[model samples]
Target: MSEKIEPTAAIEGAAPGAALSPAAQRALEEAAARRKAATAAPAPAEKGGPSGPEPTRYGDWERKGRAVDF
Candidate 1:
């Protein structure tokens, strides 16, 4: 009968490097910069301003003339 072999024996090629390639590194850096900029930028004011009346919870229901009263 054949015996079980070590898992590593199944692998036949050299291991891949842990480091990112130059172009990949640049792309990763750019993505990180864009993410940082997006989060750092001030959020745009809501359409009617910060103090505008709160939006209805069920805008679609209101449009359909449906209401649930407790």
Candidate 2:
């Protein structure tokens, strides 16, 4: 079996400034900014406000507001 590789190892190996063309570098920077913004945003308030009842954890067989049991 092949050894498992950490996801970030490939990212760390790249030199971002060395080979990217100007347009490619700009695109990369834009993507990074969007990623940062998404993570920094607050979690959305749940339905029915802060005092709402906790949502139910539906079973696997539930779909389209229906439940099926084998």
Candidate 3:
């Protein structure tokens, strides 16, 4: 079956930042600054593997046959 497609209303030729209120603009700026700082910061160094074998709680898994009889 074919479906009808509808056009969506989109605002063009507008500065996206112009839609933000003063508080929202300030928050956006703060978030951008935090993101920039995070990108600029050095990443943590990787560590070696564990010294000993780790324990697990897993058990043997089996699938039982159906209970129906002929």
Can you give the TM-score per candidate against the true fold? 0.46, 0.48, 0.42
lDDT by residue for model 2 over 1-70, one digit each (tens)? 2544222322323463355444555666677778889999999866743244332343346554666565
TM-score of 1: 0.46
Alpha-carbon local distance difference test for all models:
0.48, 0.53, 0.48
lDDT of 1 by residue, 33-59 (tens): 788899899987767332544436544
Candidate 3 lDDT by residue in tens digits, 1-70? 2544233222232244355444555566677778889999999855762244421213323224323232
Residue 51, candidate 3: Cα error in Å is 15
Candidates ranked, most accurate by TM-score first: 2, 1, 3
- How much lDDT does candidate 2 score? 0.53
Better of 1 and 3 by TM-score: 1
Of 2 and 3, which scores higher on TM-score? Answer: 2
What's the CA error at residue 38 for candidate 3, in Å?
1.0
Task: Report the CA-based lDDT of candidate 1 relative to the real structure.
Answer: 0.48
Off by over 4 Å in 1: 1-17, 49-70
Which whole-number lDDT from 0 to 100 does residue 18 have in model 3?
53
